[model samples]
Target: MHLSLGFSPCPNDTFIFDAMVNNKIDTKGLTFDTQLEDVETLNRWALEGKLPITKLSFAVYLKVKEQYDLLNSGSALGRGCGPLLIAKRDIPRDEIKDLTIAIPGENTTANLLFSIAFPEAKKKKIMVFSDIENAVLNGEADAGVIIHENRFTYQLKGLVKLMDMGEFWEETTGSPIPLGGIFIRKDVPADVRAKVDTLIHESLQHAYRHYPQLSDYVKSHAQEMDEQVMRQHIDLYVNDFSLDLGTEGKAAVTSLMEAAQKLRN
Candidate 1:
């Protein structure tokens, strides 16, 4: 059976998915028609139930849990790897609420975490994650929340970190930040979902076996990203949690969902 899959083109994603999508691993008779998009686009598509399987921010998943079932594998959940709130110059934390900030997307985990950190910061500009650094530097936004490969490159661009959102989450909740996960539409057969989950796990294992060597697939879609930064992106986002959410991972996700709900209330 052919299933549609959607995930970001970031190095970590491309690295995890390259093996399965490239036919490097046996998909157990399942074939994937993949769509490579940014996380925000994937998040919006999830709202419409646009794919059989897709990667979306945990924030968006809470809004669509009824339409999809979270897969145990292929998740981007880990500690010390959270979105960074950055600015071109020093900005007092007390001043954050009054500044116009740039976010990658309203539905992104970065935006969700930012909301939790500063609920009073109501002025926000949504833009592609890659463009946020420039937005701050040009004074279009006083501060920006950045994720993905941007976390590795921001300081190089002379951006200063105002807060490490992941650190705040860990310090407060005592859990790893549940950034994003791969989910399958609930309508997909249970057996198929299970098979897809296993395939994803195996795919990552295959990538790990060849560890520290960047694949052409990962590098190709990384655009102009430096190879070193691309590796950092993978190291930070993909981990044991990517193979399986496990107990701690699931608890972290639950904590994130509960936090989001409290904000909604």
Candidate 2:
């Protein structure tokens, strides 16, 4: 049976989900959807069980845990690769208040981080991650918190990166932030899923051997994204951290989830 898997178009997945691009891209008797979406869209599918295989945020999984089972936990967004806060070069951090801040997805990991860092920033709001640059360039927002491709594309439009949240998270937490993970439907055959998991694990190992080729992979999948941006995306989310999803990855997810849980309590 063909297994349908999905992943975002961001740089991190080149190491995890591709099938035909490399024999190394394992499907475990499954096939890939390669569906490019933000974490939010992916989560929606996971919730509905429409995603037999999907990349979803742990937070989203917590919301829809009843409907899914974890095949793996780890996203390309490392805890250290926090989102970028952008403003015009003229704006200073202390002066950032009373300014409209653009956010991407409501459920995105980055916006969650922003909330933790600035719980008192009463004036912030969200725009699509895709809309951030134009919003700032058009003055719709004083600053935009950019994620995903915008991290690389924003500078071209005169938006100044005011903060690197990924770096901030690393300095603050000493752990990689849990981003998203590969999930299989709750009812997927466990035996097949294990094979799938093994395939993904092995393929990632194969991909690691070709680390020098990652830039090329990132450019192909991520739309000519620069080497530095791609590397930052990888460094923040991948590396040894990618292979193991480590104790740190689990702890990071648990911490963030527990903190989010407090809002309900």
Candidate 3:
């Protein structure tokens, strides 16, 4: 069976999901979509029951939480896995009020977290991850909500790391960043969904058991991706955080959402 697996170009997920499909361990194949536009695209398909499997960030999942049943809380942008809200380090975290902040995209978890932490901060629109560096350096925004490769590469860009949302959340509320997840469309056969979920968990076990080979795994997925950057990317988002959200990750999400509510003007 061809599993329509929709995902963003998140490094760890692209590699792990692809490896499982490539080896043809159980499923016949996959139709992989890496578009970073919005979860609405995937959610629309999911609402129509077009997928057997898909990934949705918590913010996205919130939009259709009842439409899909979670197979597992997975592929998280774990603790220390996401980018920092950098702003020349000398800038105090609480003093961010009235400052402009660059967000990689609208309606994203980064923005969600930004809403939670820096409600008074203004937003600057930038599409790609790396561009957040340029936006901040050029004073496009006092800070930026970054993700993906930029999380590991920003020090080279001279942005002072103000705070990693992941770190901040852990210290304050303690939870993994619920960045991404896998779920089954509500109407999919329970047995089929269970089988796929089992495969994913099993494959994850295999992926971690041989984590030493992950660099090579990353190389194959990201053709132009540097091994060091890949390693850094893996380090940032994949951790015990992935094994399960555990108590901490759940608290992080709840506190973030509560914080977001308070921040809403």
Error of 1 at 132 (Å): 0.2
Give candidate 1 misplaced runs (Cα > 4 Å). Answer: none
lDDT, candidate 1, at 177: 98
* Cα lDDT of model 2 by residue, 1-265, tens digit: 6667777777777655543334555454555555667777786677677767777766575676777766653355364456888986767666666677888766667777776666656576676678888888888888878876676677788778887866776777776666677777877788877776677777676766777567354578776566777766665566655565666666877777776676536
The best candidate by TM-score is 1
Question: Each model's TM-score?
Answer: 0.99, 0.83, 0.80
Taken over the whole model, the C-alpha lDDT of each candidate is 0.94, 0.68, 0.63
lDDT of 3 at 59: 58
Candidate 2 — which pairs collide? Answer: 3-30, 3-31, 79-177, 80-166, 81-166, 82-165, 82-166
lDDT of 3 by residue, 1-265 (tens): 4456665455666545644655635543433333332443554565565665776655555555677776653556566665468775568766776678787655567777766666666645655565778878887777887777777677887777877777766676665667666777776677777666666665566667766566454566566667777766666666655545567666665665566556554
Instruction: After the best TM-score superposition of candidate 1, give how far the Cα of residue 53 lies from its true spot, in angstroms.
Output: 0.2
Which candidate leads in lDDT? 1
Worst 10 residues of 3 by lDDT: 28-37
Instruction: Return the lDDT, model 1, position 14.
Output: 90
